[model samples]
Each structure stands twice: as C-alpha cells, then as structure tokens.
Target: MSEIATFAVGSLFPELIDKEADLNDWATEVERTLDLIPSVSRIEIDPPRGFMSFNLGDATEFKDLIQHAIPIGGEIRFHILIPARIQERIKGWSVSAGNSVEEFLVTIDLSTTYPCAFIIPLGEGVLRPSGAVIVVREFLTEELDKLGSKAAIKLTTLGPSPFHAEFHIKEGDVGEILAPGIRVSRAISSGYSRWTLHYDPEVHESAEAARTVIIQRLGYEFSTFYRIVAHRNIHRFGVAAIEAWVEGTLAFYGGKGLKSWIYRTAKLRKILHDISLEILKVQLGIEKVHKQNERLIEKARDRNSKLALEKELAEKAELGFRDELSSYAEMVGVLESRHSNTTQRLTSFAVSLLGVVVGALLTAALRK
Candidate 1:
C-alpha cells in the first residue's frame, strides 16, 4: 500500500511583482528554492505531457533554453524527481523518527496553483504518513520563510494541504500569522470526524472529491500535530505516534468497512442533525405564532365583551329615557285638562252678571 503526503506553498510574488520582467528572477528563485530541499536527485522543468526529462544545470541555462518555450505571462511548473535511494533514506529517517515504516517515496511539486508546492510521500501500510509530511512541511516552511524574508517577498497560504492556511507578510517579510487556521481546522476536523463514521475503502477509490477532502483533513491534522509536538517538545514519537493513534482510532471506529458505511452512517447523522435543528426552529416558530394568535384571540374577545357591555348600557339608558318622557307628558296632559274646566266656568259666571246689570238699566229708563 503506497501512502503519500503533500506540502504546498502558494501566492508567492517577487519584490518587483511583474511576471513579465521578473521571469528570470522568478525562475532563479524557484531553482534556488528547489536546491534548498535535500534528496532532490533530478529536476525536470517543463517536461512533455505525461513524460519527464531534465537537461538544465543552472537558472541561466534553463532561462536561455526555455525562455522561448514559455509564453509571455504564462505559468511555470517544476517536477522534482527523487531517486529510490533517497526515498529509502527518507523512509529510514521516518522510521527512526518513530514511524513503523521501512519504505516510502517522496515527490515535490512546484507549480503556479494556489498551493505552489506539494511535498508528497508515497508508500503502503505506512504506519506514520504524517511524520514524513511534518518533516517536509517544517523544512519547506523554514526555507521559504527565510528566502521570502531575504527577498522582501510575501509567501501566503503556505502549508501541506489546501486548507486556506496563509503566512502573513508585513514590512516586506513573512509574518508569524497562520490565516484561516480556525476556520480550516474546524472544516477539516468536521470532515475527518464525519469520514470516520462512514468511510468505505471502495468509495474512497471512486470518490475523488471525498478522498481529497479527507486527505486534506489528514494533512491538516499532521501539521497541527507537528506544531503541538514542536511546542511541547515532551511527547515521544511525536507526529508518528499521533498519526498512528489517530489512524488506529479511525480504523477501529469505522469497523467492517462497508462501501456505503460512510455515506450511510455519516451522511445520515448529518442529515438527522440538520433535520433535528430545523424541527427545533420550526417548533419554536410554531410556539411563537401560537402565542401571538392566543394574544390576538384574547384581545378580540376582550374588545367584543367591552362592546357588548356598552351596548347593554346604551339600551338600558334608552329605555329609562323613554319612560321618563312618557311620565312627564302624562302630567302635562292632566294640568291642561284642569285649566280648560276653570276657564269655562269663569266665562259663564261673567255672562250672567252682565245680563242682570242690563235688566236694571232698562227699568230705570221706563220710570223716567
């Protein structure tokens, strides 16, 4: 079983920052960087597709021979070929470093991609892939940091995996900042944990994206373990021990590795978790809406009850007013009847008095 570890450095720009004018310098820097790495027995620049050959000895030789070969403002890639003997040496070193591995192959790739460089160690049943990865990562980081600092160039996003971890640059030098550490670590850890629950070896063969994500997570863990070991300086076997422990734990937990285990178990867990959260949110929303509706119903009932009470009062007041008016009209009618009777009596009495006076006057006139 061949195992591979990768280290990548990206977004490196020359002080001049002009790809066209700085082509020569860039090539020189790339060559110099490659030279810093040990066990690089051969280097092939711009090999034919699917084939590799090396001829250049120095930057000038490569520049003169391949200047016309590369187009203007085009990208450059270097394929480093390490001999089997060198790989054996690395394997020996890894085993000496506490890994239970006797053989592995290491390959370094320098390209124009986001991860400009990839350090890959390939082997089978390699007990500690991460040990080899960390060694190379440290070496590459140190060399790149030194070179970048000297040239006043900034090397951003330098790491073994494409987890978006970056090296900050300040004052034309690489700063001690690992950008995207928190976010990338979280994503990688979550991915690895999910994969542990559901990983299938057959699925890994076909699922390139899934494999890449898982491998990147592994690389991230490797780097993190390296940092922790280097910081504490107390752990025995360091990265190798950590890698073995992590891999063993995953393999044990994965159990009877079915092809659909990862997809079935991890994905189902994620789905169920998501659904549970959504249900919780929905239930909360329902409760909120229910409470609001209850409040509205209570307000409506209160308003209706108030209106009913007011209506009842108005009806009672109306009846009372009507009764009072009827009573007052009846009293006035009785007074008018009494006044008419008195007036009739007085008129009859006055008429009788006038008749007596007229009769007495007529008698006096006859006697005269």
Candidate 2:
C-alpha cells in the first residue's frame, strides 16, 4: 500500500520589500530551483497567484528539509506530501515548531499499515506556496533554522505531552490515531497515490493532462472574474464569478467533501441560467433602439427630397407667368398705332368739303 501525505505552505510579503516583485518572474525562479531537487519529477507553476505544485519521485528523502521561514512583517508557510513504506523498525513520530508569529505541526499514523493520508491547512491568502518557500527560505533562513532546531529536538525527545499522543488501531477503526485539529471523512486507501496542491478547480480531462489544463483555466477564470467585477456597468454574474467562489471555498477547506462540490456546482449553473436571460434582454433592447434610429433617418431624407422638388416647381411657374405678361404688352402697342392712323384720315376729308362751299358763294356775289 502506498501512503499519501499533503502539505501546505503560506507566505506574506511586505508591501515595500521588493517594489518590483513580478509574480511571473518569481514563479520562473521557483520552477528553476525546484527542478534542481533530485526527487522532483514535475513542477507546475501558477504565475498569477505565484502558486506551484511539485511531484516528487521520493518525498521521504527531503522530509527533514520541510521547514518554515519567518520574516519580519511577512509570514510564510510550507506544505509538502511524503509517501513512505511502513516497516516494523519504526514505532511512531511527531514534530512541531512555532513562535509568536507562526506555528506548524507534522504527525505520522503508526497504526495504519500503509496508504495513510494527512492534511495540513494553511490560512487563506493569494500568494503561491512555491514563491513563498523560495523567497522566505532565502530571506529568512536564520529564523527558519531556529525553528528547525526546536522541531529536531521535539522529534528526538518523544515525550508525553499535550502535543503528542499514542493510540492503538482496531481492525476497522483507522481514525484512532488522528492528529489534533485534523479532520477527514475516510482513510487513505492503498494504491498509486496522487497529490495536487493548487488554487483552482479544472475540468476532468485525462489523468496525466488534467493538471496543466486546470492551471490554465484557473488563471483565465481568475483574471476574467476581476475584470468583470471591476466594471460597474456589468450587473450580471456568470461562470467567472462562480469559479471565483468555488476556488476560494476549495482553497479554504483544502478540497474535503463530495457534497460541497455538488452544491456549489448546482448553484453556479442556476445563476448562469438567470444571467443568460438578462443578456438576452439587453440584446433585444439594443436591436429595437437601432431600428428606431434607422427609421428616423429615412424619414428625414424623404422630407428633404420633397422640399427640393416643390422649390423647383415654384421657380418654373414664376418664369411662365413673366413670359405671358410680356406678350400682352406687345399686343397693346400695335392696337394704339392703328387707331391713330384712322383718326387722321377722317379730319382731312371734312376740311376739303368746307373749302368747296366757300368758293361757290364768292363766284355768285361777283356776277350780281
């Protein structure tokens, strides 16, 4: 039977420690450093959150090196999983270390034959464990070394104290030796064990390819969530919002139950349905407004075209009226000239008759 152990580490960076601390660059450095570890077979990086997951070939060898670093005004936590074969030679073991600022505990299940599982809960935060481990180890090794000494002494002493307990396991009751403050539903079964320490939930793909796809999806979804939330105009929540909530819940609980998963997914689906309806309404309203504007533009063009045609007809009518008045004036001038010639002829005829009468009267007087 193979054993599976899970560990989590957290770190807090001071606001002004490094003004130029780029998360992507920090992730790259962590990836490179973890690659040098002999047991690490694979290293996965979450750049936006500065999170990383390391798959080790033999986790037991580096067990002692799993130490926490303390920094002034900053906190760092480390979580690691080690799978070891159970043998008769070793009896039981527990290790713990803490100060005023930080605390940690590690315990092994002695009663279980093989395939035992353990969990370490780190508090809620956004910084990645890889970057936390690397940066804290480099910057605060002195503080970590002091804590490491206490852990070593505690492991060697093995005294009976509140922090340490011994238990006997019955045939079916594996929960007899559960560590303090650790709660789990079932025992870790014997098989090829897989461990994932990440900040996002991904779609189910092939077992080998799933982690990569999940990390990519997580980054995308996280970014989209922030973008949507920042915009005041967007009132509807969708898949991105749901993903953010689920991710936070999983991170806080450390991925515990099947029932919680079902509830969260169903809730997300219902919200998405409502948001879709809202989007459809917005689209329809926009289309209606566009149609109204188009009709108004067409009406204005038609009115302007009718006005232009009316103006042209009015100018043509004015020209026709002017030409008819000029023709009437020319006909009046010809009639006036003919009437003057007729009056002159009548006056000349009357004068000739008077002249003949006067001549006859003068001739009769001279003969008498």
Highest TM-score: which candidate?
A: 1
Task: In model 2, state the lDDT of residue 361.
Answer: 80
Q: How well is each residue in 1-368 modelled by candidate 1, as lDDT tens digits?
A: 22232222222222222334444455555455555555333444442122111222222222112112221232333333334333445432354444443332332222211113333343333343344444443334554566553442223222223323321111111222122121111113322111011223333432233334433433322322222222222111222233343344344434566754544443433433443343344334334434443443344344333221122223222212224333333433443354345456656877888888888899889999
* TM agreement with the true structure for every prediction: 0.26, 0.18
Off by over 4 Å in 1: 1-21, 36-38, 47-113, 128-131, 141-368
Note the Cα lDDT for every prediction shown: 0.34, 0.28
Q: What is the lDDT of candidate 1?
A: 0.34
Once model 1 is optimally superposed onto the true structure by TM-score, how far is the C-alpha of residue 305 displaced, in angstroms? 64
Q: Give the best candidate by lDDT.
A: 1
After the best TM-score superposition of candidate 1, give how far the Cα of residue 87 lies from its true spot, in angstroms.
13
What count of clashes does model 2 give?
Answer: 10
